[model samples]
Target: MKRTLVIGDIHGGLKGLQQVLKRAKISEKDKLIFVGDYVDGWSDNASTIDFLIKISEKNNCIFIRGNHDYLLHKYLTKNDTNPMWVNHGGASSIKSYEHISEEKKQRHILFLDHLKNYYIDSENRLFVHAGFTNQNGIGNEFNPDMVYWDRTLWEMVCVMDPSSSKNNELYPKRLKNYSEIFIGHTPTTRIGKSTPQNFANVWNVDTGAAFKGCISVMDIVTKDFWQSDPVWRLYPDEKGRN
Candidate 1:
């Protein structure tokens, strides 16, 4: 049977991504859901996006838009000169595109432009790069920034008791709409977890692939998972979160 695999923030750790995919035994038959952050950390932002574009053409794939991705989009489309973006690895992403052909750069911009904020699978599993805060549910009227940057949902999940009777009261109606939700903005390592971390009905899959952690891939149905070696090891000479 084919599996639905959800991967975490990539942060341009292309080699680490390869390792995790191999460890997960990924096949074309599998459906891959990437909780984004595809660019902006290691050195291969362009290559990482390129690989994702290629694989997406031949396999079942869902790419969620991440904050870094949105920043890049904003920069490309509006020439957004936010220093915050530049301070947080955006310069590295920009540097990655310096030598690429304009054609490929345009393709990457288009790819970013077309990315979805979230996806709901047949089983009602939510896949997003970050959390949504709209009390009305994941509708089109919601904030794009929230979809790619919110950490409150994860914070709620971390503190709420999943088995508690107050679960209903503790969760917003929008969040309650899914059986499970997968996200990848905040790294598990930020909370001292080096692997995919599960809290209540939310799963945080970003194991800090941009920094000292690794990439993670989880079987959406079974919850079984695979992880790559520490990504920093793969890029021994680069400073990641700059």
Candidate 2:
């Protein structure tokens, strides 16, 4: 089987991402799949995008659109009408592009626009930025709002209680889509925690890398995981927590 490495939200931590990749020992023959949020938050959004673009051109790479990515694309394409965009890390993403030439900015926007919302491999593994919705039946087109903004799915899947299993039945078995769904956007305290119900094979790889944590990478086939130690520690909020 071809080894597939699925990366969580990068959040513009290029050095952290590099360390994760190096520790994971990614090889040229392996497929690299990004769950999105490549740019925004920390810094080096331009370099992050440029590096991913180069890797996509040279190797097998799948890029999915995260909420932040969608917001970034909106600003780049529509000149920023969405206020929610700014509140959700879009400001930093825009600042990342400020030093780039207009031509390059347009190129980046075009690239973001072309990214698919999800990717499914032949092995029945589904990869999406956020969780999918089952409203109006399953296999329906992914709702953009849910894709970019919904936290219900994470709540439904991430709770650590046996009762949470009941929530899994909300989606009809017919709509139980993929054998496994790889996702990002929800920052778990740990990486690759299975959903409350065993019915959905969900892997959440976002380890809060932007908030004094580490970036994570997981091998789909082997279930092996790797992460970097926090390289940049920012002061915590008034709550004194990330």
lDDT of 2 by residue, 56-113 (tens): 8766999988888877777777787477666555666777788899888887877897
Off-target runs (Cα >4 Å) in candidate 2 are 135-138, 160-175, 190-200, 234-242
Least lDDT summed over 10 consecutive residues: which range in candidate 1?
164-173
TM-score of 1: 0.94
lDDT of 1 by residue, 1-242 (tens): 79999999999899999888999888889999999999889988889999999999878999999999988888777878699988888888888877989798889899998899899888888898889777666665356668888988888778876675525575557667788999999988888999999887789999998889999999988899999999989999999983
Alpha-carbon local distance difference test for all models: 0.87, 0.71
Off by over 4 Å in 1: 140-142, 166-172
